[model samples]
Target: MSTTTMKYAVTDSLMMLRRSMLHIARYPSMTLPLIIGPIVFLFLFVYVFGGTLGAGLDGSSGGRADYVNYVTPGILLLTVAGAATATAVSVATDMTQGIVARFRTMSIFRPSLLTGHVLGSVIQTLLSVAVVLGVAVAIGFRPNANPAEWLAAVGILTMLIFAITWVAVIMGLVSDTVETASNLPMLLMLLPFFGSGFVPTDSMPGWLAAIAENQPFTPVMETLRGLLMGTEMGNSPWIAMAWCAGITAAAFAGSVALLNREPGR
Candidate 1:
């Protein structure tokens, strides 16, 4: 793109970012669920079910001494789940209110509007992930990996959040109503249950194991667990990266295609 266009993109993106932050500031209650849902899930899994599950899995080996550590990654994923949904709702609300259409009629760069929303969501996801990490630490969860590995784990989670946000963006762009947009996030949240989030694939039935082993979330969880627990991820890192890339590509292409389609086409 030309320098003028690049400048427009940056400026428009910043404007969008500021507007989103303003919305958050004006209505602080919107952030409550982002904080609460992860904490609730962490407590339920770590305290209520942790002991029995850890004992059954580890037995005398003490292989899984800290059940909190086992579920921390899942909790981080949950944090992203909450943030992603909120982002979808915001974007959809803007679309339905003619905010996006109004902007499109202006001289502003169009893609930057979407970029700003996605960037804001990324920021929110990072903050939520940090809070979840803190909660995990307070509950006695410890990372077995070095600083580099921990960074890698965070990077993986960030990428997953980014990929998922695109899916949310697509929903926001296409949904006819704000209520419909809100449903997209809940649908995305269901992905973890089918993967290695709450339970290990080995503990599941054969058919379920097969599904979990191949699902995108399983590899992402495995990669995070490997980094946190210093265990072999069994090739999950590569699979996870592939899944992220695939989703990112598909979602971006779909969003662009939908945006470009004529209103009645």
Candidate 2:
């Protein structure tokens, strides 16, 4: 791209980003569920199911604390899943409200619309993750990671959110209704349960465990577990990053293609 075009794209994307942020501020209700869902699960699992689950992990009577540590990473990933749903709904809302069609008529960089959604969702997702992490710490979830590990955790998280948000943008782009967009990302929410979010793959049946072991969420969860709690990560971090890269590239291409073909664009 030429420098002038690049500059224009950046300017338009920033404007779109500001617009997205304002929309979020005005409709904070859209974000509340994303934050609340993980918290409810955290409390539900820790207080109600922690003892039995924790005991299974370490064979101790006071296993609730251990369970808290094991479960927090999954809950953190859940927060990102919730962000995906919110992004999809936001995009769908824009499409249905005729705002996207309106934008296409303007001379602004066309990609800026989706770019704004991705950037805004990243900011929102990270803030939501921080809030959830604080709650986890309050409820006996502890991390022994140094500054570098903490930074790595944040980096992986941001990458995952960025990748997932692009996928959500595509979901939003294709969805005919806001409700459909909200529901489309529901599968992401179940990923942790199917993988190693709430429990270990070894504990699952062989067939189920195999599926869980190979899925995206397990590696990401394992990476987080290692970073935060000093658990053994092995190749999980690299695997997780690879998944993020692949997903982002595919989703970005799909989103751009969809936008190009969009009616009235």
Over 1-265, each residue of candidate 1 has an lDDT whose tens digit, in order, gives 9998898889989998888888886877777788889899888887788887666554334223467777778778878877877888888898789787777678888777777888888887788788878978887888878989988988898889889888888998888898998887897677677777877778889998998888778899889989988767888999999999899889888876776566546
TM-scores across all candidates?
0.93, 0.97
Backbone clash total, candidate 2:
0
Model 2 TM-score relative to the real fold: 0.97
Quantify how close model 1 is to the true structure by its C-alpha RMSD in Å.
1.9
How many pairs collide in each candidate, listed in order?
A: 0, 0
* Candidate 2, lDDT over the whole model: 0.92
- Pairs clashing within candidate 1: none
Estimate every model's Cα lDDT from 0 to 1.
0.81, 0.92
